[model samples]
Target: MKSFWCEQAWLPDGIASRVLVRADRGTITSVSTVDTIPLGCERLYGVVLPGFANAHSHAFHRALRGRTHSDGGTFWTWRDRMYAVAERLTPESYLHLARAVYAEMAIAGVTAVGEFHYLHNGGNEMGEALRQAAVDAGIRLTLLDACYLAGGIGQPVTGVQERFSDGTGERWAARVAELREDGNTRVGAAIHSVRAVPRETLSLVAGAFPDRPLHVHLSEQPAENEACLAAYGLTPTELLHEAGALTARTTAVHATHLSTKDIGLLGSAGTGACFCPTTEADLADGIGPARELRDAGSPLSLGSDQHAVIDPLLEARGLEHGERLRTGERGRFTPADLVAALTNHAAVGWPEAGRIEVGAPADLVAIGLDSVRTTGCAADQVVLAATASDVAVVVSGGKVVARNGVHETLGDVGKLLKAVV
Candidate 1:
């Protein structure tokens, strides 16, 4: 029995006004753009939009944002530094770190997150710690419990990365199932990449998790592509397709070095590409043909991978910005497209149905039209000009987790980060 009205709203098509939205049992019960605000309903005077869904995230990586940029190196060198951070995490430490990081996402107006987690072997306590962290942070997590058995296509984990492996594919599935949730979090599956997971292991993961979401890191590096081609005589995309992992529920993260045929396969299979713009740009992972993928009818989503950047507005802008840089064009997507990716398409990575329509979860954000980045801006300007700091209110599943520019879980984050990171 919760209801609210916004002065302006982002409907499926365009900027709308006088939107009367009702919620019951956390689902959006009704919506009307032409209706007047109810006399006693809670109302927010700003441009209200659907909450952003982060299709991919590594919560613990938020600790490594500034530390990884000093050396101009490939993803391998970055992995060394990343490994150092991953090695130091105990379950308690991870929970503490993740709680803070998820709060930051809430403030950024990201309601649900798909965490591609692989740091598994600190023991059973580590599993408990990750689960608690997701709950404390208020993000409905799809803990894509990853099967990372090898260092490359043919090599086993040799050093710090060994902890990410769960010994065998059977053990990996057991561990993934143990990281479950019935209420808040939805546990999902992940193959760290074709490099980290062998061909037999790929089929094992797919066979274990039938009719569920599967995510994998694909073609993010030239080395990975070269290694995959050398090992399998096929591109990473083809290897995956050959293993029968390409499906509508499958999500390919950082799909940068794909061929035209690979793109066509992904489009035809109805698989989604999750673009982690800032992380890809920071790592020099090459531009993903997002515009090409979109034109091919592949659904595109966004993620704040590696926590190099946490702003969905900035992520949306990065999508357009990358397009403009490639084509020398302005406004690659209308505001509606930007909003849809953040809201609807990104939701494909999660369990909940997204939209302001009936039976959809009440995950929404109310942007402050009067904020510094929003001054003299309409709903379109919010996407074009605003940052995460401009997000004023965040509501998820009929619960208010963030309000008035602050999240309920914001305190102690700076302190928790300083100790572990």
Candidate 2:
């Protein structure tokens, strides 16, 4: 059992002062107001929000961060470089790299991450490495094992693409069934994209893991939509809808390039949209219709895809910034809405998390208001004013995993990343 006293906490009702939270075995037991701090209770100053959930991530891409920005190149060119790195990663090497990457996320206030893993190398070794990595980092993980069976529409697997394919959807499902989940991990399903998975196999992958969360790489580029439309005579969104892949349990990773009808199809089906604002911008992927998707019944979530940046606070801020730039209006999404998206654990199969109420996971992120970036900001509006540097203390599953931008158990995250990358 453990107790924490927050100077100010973002409770479900509203921000409360002098709040006390109790936890036992990593689940929040009780929450109430307190006049004074009790002995042995950890004191957390500033505003304490629920730990951020990175709804979309590619753990191995952390290595491609600053290395791909030298020459101006298109997303296709970036893929060649990414594939080069993917081909060289062994299970042992990936375990070390992913551990540092996840530890980096921990210090940035992410308590759970949804890893869109496709670098299987035709087995579950890489998947097992990711599971162990998350356990060592003291954060929850949802491995969205992807099904990749083609190089492109009507194209055969070639070069490094051969490493990603499992011959057929049946083979993909059989291998995925071998991946067992533990207390710190959940196994989920992903369709690599309309380009990788053919029309015939889409439905099989969609229904393969009916009880778990489903994620997919939506139209992040205009070329992808062009190819999908030319090949199937339908938009990628339409293709997914035809396959019965759009559902409340499904999340579209980068709904960037979409037709009006495409948006309608996704929105009407109660699917979720996960916008990676940093990665979208970094990779030259256009800003997605975030506001429209939200109003269309699709819940919104945020992620630091590709690890161009791993700060959920920045992603939350970028989400609003992108909307404002697209619509020529400010406050497209209120701070509360941004916070909701930042801590949307349900998008990653952890529906019981991302809230401060009892019965949720005991995940808390204390953001210091005194930081230079957030000196005069209101507690509720800190999502716009602060960055990951303001995260003073992080508690995941009732344990202090990071303090003041440094991982508790791993010490200097920079050193860890340096040793691996």
Candidate 3:
């Protein structure tokens, strides 16, 4: 059993002072308000938030963070550089890189990550490496194994994309079926995109793991939508809807370029929209219709896709900032809304995580109210005002894994990342 006392904790109802949380075997057993600290409890100061869930990621892309922007280029040019990194990674090298990436996520207050992995290399070894890396770094992982079959809408696999395809959709399913879930890892499925997956195969990938979470990269770039429309005579969203892939369990990552009809299809189908605001901005992927998507019925979640920035706080701020810049109005999403998106563990298939309540995983993140970045901000407004540097303590699954941007057992995350990337 473990116990922790929070100065202020974000409860389901609202923020509560002097909150005492008790956990047993990684499950939160009880939460209550108390006036005095218990004798043996760990005390967490400042504002305590539920752990952030990075709902979309590609771990290997962390290597290309600062290396791809020397020359200004479109998303396609940036992807060419990304593919080069993917080609060089083996199972052993990827393990080290992902361990560092996950540790960096932990220190930034992210407890779980949904990796949209498409680097198959013709087997499950790469996926196995990612699973081991997550365990080593002390965070939960949803391996959203992506099915990438084509070079484009109708083109065959070419160049480095050969490593991403399993030859066919059936082969992809067989490879995925071999992946087993453990206490800290869940196996999910993803369609890389309408462009990468042919229409005939989209349904197979979506139905491969029906009981698990299904994610897809949806219209992140205008070129993709244009290509998809030119080939299929239907928008990407319409193609996905036609294939019956738009469901509550399905999440459309980067539903950025969408029409009125497309938004309705996603919203009415109850598909989640995961916005990687930092990466979208870094790649100049354009501002997505985040608020409009939510209003129409899609739930919103956040992620650090390319590792251009690994801060969930900054992603939250960027989400709202993008909305402000696009709409010329403030408060597009309230702080509570942002918090909900930040901790939506269900978006990554961890339905019982991301809450400071009984029966949930005992994941907690303590943000320093006294830090220079967050010094005078209101408790509710900290999401907008603070950065990852404000995170003082990160507890995952009832265990303290990181403190002040350093992993408890892995030592310095910066050193780990520096060695790998």
Instruction: Give per-residue CA lDDT, model 1, range 216-239, as digits (tens).
Output: 888999989899888889998998
> What lDDT score belongs to each candidate, Candidate 1 first?
0.80, 0.95, 0.94
Candidate 2 achieves a global lDDT of: 0.95
Deviating ranges (above 4 Å) for candidate 2? none
Q: What is the TM-score of each candidate against the true structure?
A: 0.94, 0.99, 0.99
Error of 3 at 68 (Å): 1.3
Query: Cα RMSD for candidate 1?
Result: 2.1
Candidate number with the higher lDDT (1 or 3):
3
* Ranked by lDDT, top first: 2, 3, 1
Cα deviation in Å at residue 325, candidate 3?
0.4
Prediction 1 global C-alpha lDDT = 0.80
- Which should have the higher lDDT, number 1 or number 2? 2
Q: What is the C-alpha RMSD of each candidate to the true structure, in Å?
A: 2.1, 0.6, 0.7
Clash pairs for candidate 2: none
Tens digits of per-residue lDDT, candidate 2, 128-182, equal: 9999999999999999999998888889889999889899999999999999988
lDDT of 3 by residue, 263-334 (tens): 999999999999999999999999999998999999999999999999999999888999999999999999
